[model samples]
Target: MFDFVRKHTRLLQFVLVLLIFPSFVFFGIQGYSRFTGGEATAVAKVDGHDITRAEWDAAQRDQVERLRRQMPGLDPKFLDTPEMRLQVLDGLVRERTMLAAADKLHLVTTDDRLQRIFATDPQFAQLRNADGSVSKEFLAAQGMSSVQFAQRLRQELSMRQVLQGITATAVGPAGSSGTALDALLQQREIQLQRFEPKDYLAKVSPSDADIEAYYKNPVHAAEFEAPEQADIEYLVLDLEALKKDIKVPEEDLKKYYTENEARYSTPAERRASHILVKAEKSLPEAERAKAREKAEKLLAEVKKAPGSFAELARKNSDDPGSKERGGDLDFFGRGAMVKPFEDAAFGLKPGEISGVVESDFGFHIIQVTAARGGDKKSYEEVRAGIEDEIRKQLAQRKFSEVAVEFTNTVYEQSDSLKPAADKFKLELRTASAVKRAPQPGATGPLASTKFLDALFGNEAVRNKRNTEAVETGPNQMVSGRIVKHEPARQRALAEVKAQVRDRVAAEQAAALARKVGEARLAELSKAPETALPGATLTISRAQTRDLPREVVDATLRANADKLPAVEGVDLGAQGYAVVRLLKVLPRDPATGDMARLQQQYAQAWADAESQAYFASLKTRLGARTTEAAAAAASSPAAN
Candidate 1:
C-alpha cells in the first residue's frame, strides 16, 4: 500500500491540494477571529514577535494535561501555584526559541518521514489501517487534520535536529571525570560507639514544673493547631450502573455483526524465516549488487534443498536478531514488516521459498514456515463480548439523556439529594468528617476534590443545600452537601497534658544523654589509648548499612590525622552517639573503577553543554515576558 502511494505521488499531491484548499480557508477564518478576540493579548515577546495570551494558555493546558495523564489522582492545587505557572510559561518560551533556532539552521523533515512517524507513534497505533494510512476518524479524534499534524511533526523534527547538532560534540575534559570518580569512590576506616537512650533514662528525671514549662512554650503550641474539616452526604449517578439494565435487541446485534464484522475478526498472519544479506543503504552500486547476487544464490539453494534452509541460515545469515534461531521472524501480522519483505514472504505458501527480495535494509532470501490463527470467530463465540459492547453503547446514550435530568432534579430540589437519588435510583451515601483532601476510608465519587469543594462552598455549607452535579470521573456525576463542618482551632493544653508531659520528659532525657556522651568523649580524647564504653565497630567511610546519618557525617568529617579523634553527635530521643576516628586510612586502590564512570561523566557533560547552548539561544532570542504577564503568572487568580 505504501509502495502504491509512493508510486502515485504526483497524482496524490494534486488530489490533496484540491481537498485541502477549503480547509485552509476555514482555518484562515479561525486565525482571523483568534487575533481579533480578547485572547489576542500579548503576554511576551521573542525578538519583537508577540506571544499571545491564548498561546500561553494552550501551552500551560498541554503541560497540565500531560502531567495529569502521567500521574493519576494528582492534586490540581499543587499545579495552581505561582511557581508552577511561571515554569510552564518559561517552558513555552524555551520551545519557541528552539523552533526559531531550527528555522535559522534551515532544518527540514521530509513528508515520507512524517508519515512513518505518525504511523508508528503509540498514541495512534490503535487507529492505524492495514494499508499503513491513518483514517479520518483518528484525525478527528485527535482534533487535527493531516496538514496540521504534518506541520507540527516538521517543527518537532527540525528542533530535534538543531539540538542534536548543538550538543553532538559535547565531550568531558581529560582526567577531570577520573578525579571526580576517585573522590566519590574513596573509602576511609573509622570506629563508632553508640550510647543507648535506656542507659541514661534513669539518670535524667524531670519534675512537673519542667513538663509544664515545655508545654506552655510558644514554639510547641504551633504543633497542636488543627486543620478545618467537614463531613458530606452525596448522591452518585454513574453511567456504568445503567449497563446492567440495558438489553441489546437480537436483531440490532445481528445488524451490528454484519456491518462491523472486521471488528470481531483477526487478520491472517504468517510465520516466516529469512536469510538476510546485509548491505548498507548508502553502499556503492557494485557492493550492493554483490550482496544481492549472494542472496539470489542462497534463494536458489533453499529452493533446491528446503531442509538445508536452517543450516544455511545459521552459517550465512547476516541478521543477528534471528541468525542463531534459523532466521525465524516467528508469526507476524500485516503492517508489521517493510512492504517488500512482507510482500515476498506472504506471497509464498508454507514450505515454499521466494526469490531474493530487496528492501532498504538490503536483500533477503525468504521461506514461509507456518501460518495460523486468522479464522473469523463464529457469532456464538463472540456473543458475550458483542452484547457487553452494545450494552455499554446503550448505557452511554441513556447517560447523555439522564445526566441532564439528574442535574435538573438536584438543582431544582437543592435542599435534599433524596429527590435526585430517587429519580436516578442512586444511593444517597453519607461520608463522615472529610477534609479538603480525601477522607480516610472514603472511596467512590464523594472522595474527589471537586465534590468536596462544591459541598464545602458557601452555597452548600451556608445555605445547607445540595451542590450542583459535578463530574467527578468519566460518566459519573456527584451532588453533595455538607452534613457537618468543623472550624480549626488550637487544641487545649489540658486535653493534651499527658502527651505534653511525655514529650517534655523525652526531650530532657535526650539532653541528659548528650551531656553524658560529650563528657565521656572529652575524657577519651585526653587519654592516649582509651576505649569508650558501649558497642564499638570499625566502619568504612562508604559503609552506612545501618548507621545513623548524624553518626556517619561526624565520622566522615572528623580530623583523623591523629589517632582517636572523637566527635559527639546529638541523637535526640534515641540519645547521642560518641564516634571515635581511630585511624586515617587512604582510599583503597581497588575501590574506584574508571571504566564504570565514563558513560555517566560523558552524559553529564552533554547535559551541561545542552543547557549552556539553550541559555545562549534564549539570550540571543531576546525573549521577555511583559510585566503584566509576569504579575499575572505570580497571582493565584491568573487564568
Candidate 2:
C-alpha cells in the first residue's frame, strides 16, 4: 500500500488537495489555524518564549522513557501521570530559564574548551577512543551524531557557568551555624511520664445510657457506618488467556530454536596477552618506524621462546594497566578492542603469536592464550524455553487479532458477561462486597482503577448489565457488571452498641489522662526538685527519647531559666505527657564531624543562594506556568 502511494506521489498530492482544499475553502483558514498556531496550547512561558504543548508532551515522553529504563519493573501507568507531566514541565522550564540566563549574560563555551573537557574528563573516558577521537558507535547507540553531542555539551557548559558564578562566591555565615546547631541539638535532661488511653481503658466503663448518648451524637455517626459495596461479575482477557488456547508444533519450536540459535549459545571469547611497543599514529614517521622495528624484534623473540613472552611483555609493554600482569588482557569478546588489535588477536590460534601489528595505540606482538565458548546448546537442552517463547509470541500476536472482537462482544451483549466469556474461553469470576475503590491486596481486574470505575458506573449500576470493555493494562481488557449494590448507611444503636460503648469509654479515659497530666504539671511546677515518676533520659529536638513530637516541642519550649522546668503536652488520641526539664546540654559531636558538618552547611547555603538568584532570573525573564498546569499539579492521583 505504501509502495503504491510512493510511486503515485504526484497523483496522491493532487487527490489530497481535492479532499482537504474544499474543507479549507468552506471553513476558511480557521480550520487550519489550530495547526499553524500550535503554540495556542502552550503550558508555560520562559523569557517570553512559549513552551508549546507538543514540546511539553515530547519532554514528558522522554522523561517517562528514562524512568522506564531506570526501573524496568515499574508500571508505566504510574510514570506517565499528571504529576509526572507537571514535574517534566518544571524541569523543561528550569532548563529554559538557565538557557535564557546564559544568553543574557553572553556566557558561551568555546569549542576549544569543549574539546579540552571531553579529552580530559574521566567521566567520558569510555566514549573516547585510544587516539582521543569520539567513538561513533557510542554516539550512535545514544541516537546522536558528533555535531548533536557537541551542541548538547556546549549548551550544558554554558548553563553551568550561570550557576557556577553564584556557588563560587557563596559561604555559610561564619560562627552562626555553630550557635544554631547548639540550639537545635540542645539536650534537656528530663523525665518522660506518659498517661496512655489504653492503660486507662480497663479503669473506665460506660453505662448503657452513656453509650446511647454517644451513639446519638452527630459527630460520631460516621464511625458506625460502612462503605458502599457491590456484588460484581467480571471478565478478563489478556495474554495469559490467549496463551492457553495457543498450540505450537514440535517442528515449529525446533525451527524457531534454529533461527535464534545464537541466543542459546555463549559468545566466543579470546584471552590474549600482548607485548606493546609504543608507536602512536601521531608520532614522527622516523620514530614510528623505529618502534615497529623494535616490536618486530620482540615478536621474533617471543615466537622463538614462548615461555619468555611474559617476561618480554613485562619489560617491553607500555600499557600500564596490564604491564604488571604480563600484558594479560583477560577474556574479551569481539569489538572489545581496537579494530586492528582485535583482528590480529582473533585470527591467531591458541598458543600462537601474531606478527608485529600497528594500531592507534602502538605496535603490538599478540599471543592467543586460550579460547572458549561459541558452542550452541542441543535441541533437547533448550526445548522447554523455546516452546515457552513461541507460545508467548503467538499469544501477543493473537491479542491484537482478537482485541477488537473482544471489545465489540462486551459492548453488543451488554446484558451479560457469560456470552463474551464463553466466546473467548475465559472464566467469569464473581466477588461479593467489593468497594468502589480497590480493596487491600486486590489483584488483576479487581485492583485496576479503570475496571473498578467501569464496574460502578451509572449505566452498569442502573441497568445491572455488563460494562463496555476497558483496557486495564497492556493488551489486557476487562469488563464487569454490577449484580447487587449496597448503599452507605448509618447503623442503629442496637447494632453497634458495643462499638459505641468503647468510644464513650475512650473519651472518658482520654479526659482522665489529661486531667491527671495537668494536675501533675501544676504540682511539679510548685516543687521543681521533687521526684518525678518516669524514665530519665536526655531529650532534644533531634532526640525525642521515644516521646511524641508534641511532647518534645513542649519540653523544649518550657521555661528553663531556673534549674528545672515542668511542662504538660496533650497528645490527642495517644493521651497526655508530663515532662520535667532538668538541665540543658550541648550536642555531642562525633569524631571529625564538626568539619564535615560545617562543609555540608556551607554547601547547603550555596545551593540556597544559587536558587534565590535563579528565582530572580526567572522573574526578570518573565517565566510563568499556565493555569492548566497549576490545576493538574494538585490532582490527587499525580503524587
Candidate 3:
C-alpha cells in the first residue's frame, strides 16, 4: 500500500489510509522509539505488546531536536547515555498507550471541532496572514501538513476526552468543599531540641593509654592528617579606597525623581460580583448549546430588571462558595480575572449589570457593585520611595566620576588610604577582623569579590601598598588599604583544649555505640528469636512514601540492624530504636486518600488494554518494521 502510495497519482486515497494511518500509528510508536542508533530496538513490553526500536529512535530524535532548539549550546554528549534514551522512550510509550486506548474506545474528534481548535490556537494564528491562510514554508518548518497536523490534534483531543471522563467525576468544581484540600494547606509548627555528643565531654575523659589505643584504629588515625594549604600574594583592587573622592551632583537627583513619578502612585481597585459557568473540554455539544441558551435566557431576565441580578446569581451560580453571598468576588486589582471578564467588569458603571461575557470559564454576567478611582500620592507621602530612587541613581553617577580620579591619584602618589582620605578631607573608618568578606561601612559603594581579590593579592598585602580601585556596582567604586595583617595559623594545644575535648567525646560516643552494637548483633546471630530481657525497643509506624523525621534521625544516628534482638540502639538525644523488618508493603490503590488515584489506576488499566489491541493490529497488518525497530523492541527500557 505504501509502495503504491509513492507511485500512484491517487494522492487523496494515499493520504487518507496509507499516509494517515501509518503516520498516526508511527507517531504513537515513535514516542517510544530511540532516535540515535542507525537501527531501532524495543525497550519495554506490556504483556506481549512490543514497543519497536524504530519508534523509540524516532521519539528520541524528536526529543533531541526539541532540546537542541531550547539550549543551542548544550553538550551533545548528554544524549549519549542509555538512561537518557530510556527516559525518552518511556514518555513516548505512555503517550502511545493512551492514544491506542482512545482508538479502541472509538473516541474521536470531528473535523469541524478540530478545525475550530486550530483556528483559535494563538501559535497558528501568529503564523497566518491577514487573508487567514497558513504559509506553506512555516508549516514545513514545523514538520506538519494540514492533514497530518489535524489528525494529530484530533488524536490529542480524543485522549483528552477519555482523560476527562475518568478524572472529571472525581474532581468537583473548584469551589467544592473537601477535607483533603484543607489537610494539604495545614501547617505544623514544631519546637525542637538538638543533643550533641560534645555535651557529654566532661564524662568522657580518655586516658593516654586510650588515646594510643584509638590511634591504633585506622579510622581514628585518618582524622589527624594535616590539610594541604597554599600561601601566595597577588595584586588587589579595593573599592573603599576610592570613596573619599565620590560626590553627588544636585541636578542629577532632581532629574531622576521627575522621570519616574508614576511608579510612586497607587492604582484604583473595584469590588465586584459575578456568576461563572465553568467550561469543560469534554462537555457534550448538546449540553454546551443548552448552557448557552440558559445564559441568554438569564441575561434577558436580568436585563429586564437589573436590580435583581445579585438575587438571581445567588440562586443559580455554580460557584457554591460565593453564590450565597450574591457572587461577591471582593475587591481586586487589574490582571486578576479572565481578560474578557475583567474588561467587562472594569468597564461597567457602578451598580450596572454587564451583558453576557465570554471567557475560557464559560460565560459570565458581571455586575460592578462599586468602583474606586485611582489616587496620586502627595510628595511628602511618597518621600521615602522617591529618596531611595534618587540615592541609587545619584550614587551611580558620582561613583563613576570619582573612581577614575581616585585610581590615577593612588598610582601617582602614596599608595595608602590615609593619604587619599586626608587629601579629600573624608572620614576614615577601620574594620574589625574579617576573612574574605567586606566589613560593614568599610565596603563603601564598590564592594565585590573582585575588590576582595585585589585586596588579598600579592602587591597589596605582601608589598604593603594600596592596590588599584575597582568597580563593584553601577556608579560605585572602591579601593582599600590594609590597616592590619594576620596570617593563618593552627592554635596551640592550650588555646584549643575545649574544642579538642568536644571532638574527643564524640569519637568516644561513636566507638562505644559501635562496640555495644557489634556484641548485640553477635548474640542475636546465635539465637535469632531470643529477646534480651529488660531492654526497651521503641517501634514506630512509618510509610514507605514518607518517613517520619524522628525515624530518619534515629536511623542516621546509629545502625539499627546491628542492635541485638529486643535491644535498642541509643539515637543520641532523640531516643533509642531497635528495628526489624516486619513486612515490606507495596503501594495499595484502595488505601490512597486522594480521589484522583482511583481515576489514574482506571486510565492506566485502560491504556494497557488499548496497547494490547494495537499490538494485535500490527501483527494482523504485517507491518514491515526495520531491523532497528526489532532491536528497540528487545530492550526493557523501550516503552
Candidate 4:
C-alpha cells in the first residue's frame, strides 16, 4: 500500500488532504448520563467503563453529518453501511479506551482550557452566543447538550495531550535530516523488458489430463464454495399506505398552533449602522487600549457631525463587510449581533448615536436607522400548514403503535406472515431470489440487511416459518419466510470443469513465466550496464506518464544501491515483467527541500507511532463489541 501511495504521490496527497481533518473534528457526542439516564444500553466496555449505545449513535451521526457537509454531491446511502458503522464504533471504542487510561493517570482538562479549545475550533466557535456563552439551541440542533459537549471536548483534549507526547518521540532524532534527504531526493532510471502473458500462453499449453488433475486439487475446492441464498415471501407494512386512513381534527390543529406559536412568529428587526475598530481578541492590553481610543475618537466625530457618518465610516471603519456601504449592516434581529453591540444599537432611538461599545471583534460605535418586523402570524394564515403538520404527527404516532403490534403478531404467530398482513392490511410480497447481501438496484424492505438476515436464518429457512419482524425503513416493518433455501456447498467439478480448466492453465502459465523471468533477471543483474532484448524506456522519479501502476510501483520500490539491480513481478493476466535498474541519479536538494522532506518523514513516523499506541491501548482495555449493540443503537425508541 505504501509503495502504491508513493507511486501516485500527487493523488495520495489529494486524498489525504480530504480525509485528514474529519477524523479529529468531532461533534455531537449525543446523550449525557443525565439525558439518557438508565435507558441507554452499553455498546462496548473499556477498562470496565461502558461506552453507551447513545454515544455510539451520536458519533455515527456526527461522522455522517461531516461527510455530507464536506462532500455535498455524494450519495448519502453510500455512507450508510455496516462497514462505515463499524468504523465509527471502533473510533468510539478507541476514544473511550484512551479516556479510561487518562482517568487512571489523573489527566483532566481545565475549564479555561476547554473554553479556549471551543473558541479555537471552528465547529464549536459558531455555537458561541452574543453573551459569550454557548448556545443551547445550537447545541441541541447538533444533538448534544452542554454537559455532553463539555465532557466530549474534555475527553478529546486529554487524549490529545497524551498522544502529543507519545507521537513526538517518533519524529526524527537530531541531525538525521541530511542523511534522509540524500535517499529521498535520489532518482532512479531503469531498463525494462516487457513480457506479456499472451507471449507465454503460446509457449506453455496444458493438456486435458493436467487441467483435470489441477481442478481436482483439494486446495481449489474451497474457493468454489457457493454462498448461501434464499427466496423469500414477505409482507411489508408501509406507514405511508397506512397513513391514508389517519384523520386530524380542527381542534388538534388549533392546539398545535397555539403551543408552537414561536415557529409562526417573526422577531423584531433593527436596521443598524456601526463603525468598528478591529483588534484581535488575543491582542495585548496596550494594543486593545489603542483600538478602543481610536474607536472613541471616531464616536466623538460621529456625534459632532452625524450627517457625515457615511463619509467617516467609509474612510475609517475597520469592518470591510459594511465599511463601503457606510457601515450599513442592513436589518437584523436579536441574537444576530454580539450582545454588547446588539444592546447598544437596540437601546438607542432612531437617528441616535450610542456610546462606544466593546465586543469580541473590538469596539463599535452604533446608530439605529429603523426598527421593523416582529409580526405574529394569525391562525387564519397558518391554519393549513398547522393542520398538515398535526396530521402527519398523528399518523406517525399511530404508525409506531401499529408497527410494534405488527412485529409482535408476526413473531407470536411464527407459522406465516398472513396474521401480520391481515392485521396491517398489507399485501404479502414474494422475492424470487435474494442474495446474502442486497444486490445492485434492489429496493424496498427486501434490500434491508436486517430483513435479509431474518429471511435466511435457521427458523425462517430450515423450519419454513416466518422470522421476527424487521424494521427496514422509517415507519416500515417486514417479516419473511423462505420460499426456497440454498445451503452453501461446493460446486460439482463437472459443473465448473471449463472454468476450473482455464484457471489451472493460467496458474501453470504464470508459474512458468515467473520462473523464466526470474532466471533472466538474475542474469541481467550480474552486469551493471547490459541491455535486455526488449523495449527500453527512460523513467524518472517525478513521473511515470505511460507505465502501468504495478510496473511503476515495482520500479520505485526496487533497490538501486547497486546498478543493474533486478526485480520481477507477476502482473496477473498481463504476465510478468523483469525490471533492471540501470542508473541511480542523485540531484542537489533545492531550497527548503530538505526541511520539507524531513517534515514529511516525521509525519509518516508520527502516524505509525500513533497507530501502534492505539493498537496497544485497545488490547490493554480488552475492548469488544457486537452486531447486537450496533442494531440497538440504530433502532429508534419510543419518546
Clashes of each: 0, 0, 41, 0
- Evaluate model 1: give its lDDT: 0.72
User: Which lDDT tens digits does candidate 2 get at residues 51-79?
Assistant: 76656666665556545654555767677
lDDT of each: 0.72, 0.78, 0.54, 0.72
lDDT of 4 at 193: 77
lDDT (10s digit) by residue, model 3, range 184-231: 222221111223344444456766555555444567544543332223
lDDT by residue (tens digit), candidate 1, 425-510 = 77778766677777666677756777777777888878889899998878888888887888777788777777787787677778
Between prediction 1 and prediction 2, which has the larger lDDT? 2
lDDT of 4 by residue, 25-136 (tens): 3433221112221366777766655666666666666666656654655545567566776777777667666655666566777889888866765554445676667777
Query: Every model's Cα RMSD, please?
Result: 12.8, 12.2, 17.8, 14.5
Q: What stretches of model 3 exceed 4 Å from their correct place?
A: 1-203, 208-309, 312-369, 383-388, 422-427, 436-448, 532-639
User: Which residue pairs come into collision in candidate 4?
Assistant: none
Worst 10-residue lDDT window, candidate 1: 21-30
Clashing pairs in 1: none
The prediction achieving the highest lDDT against the true structure is 2
Worst 10 residues of 4 by lDDT: 28-37
lDDT (C-alpha) at residue 278 in model 4: 95
Q: Pick the candidate with the highest TM-score.
A: 2
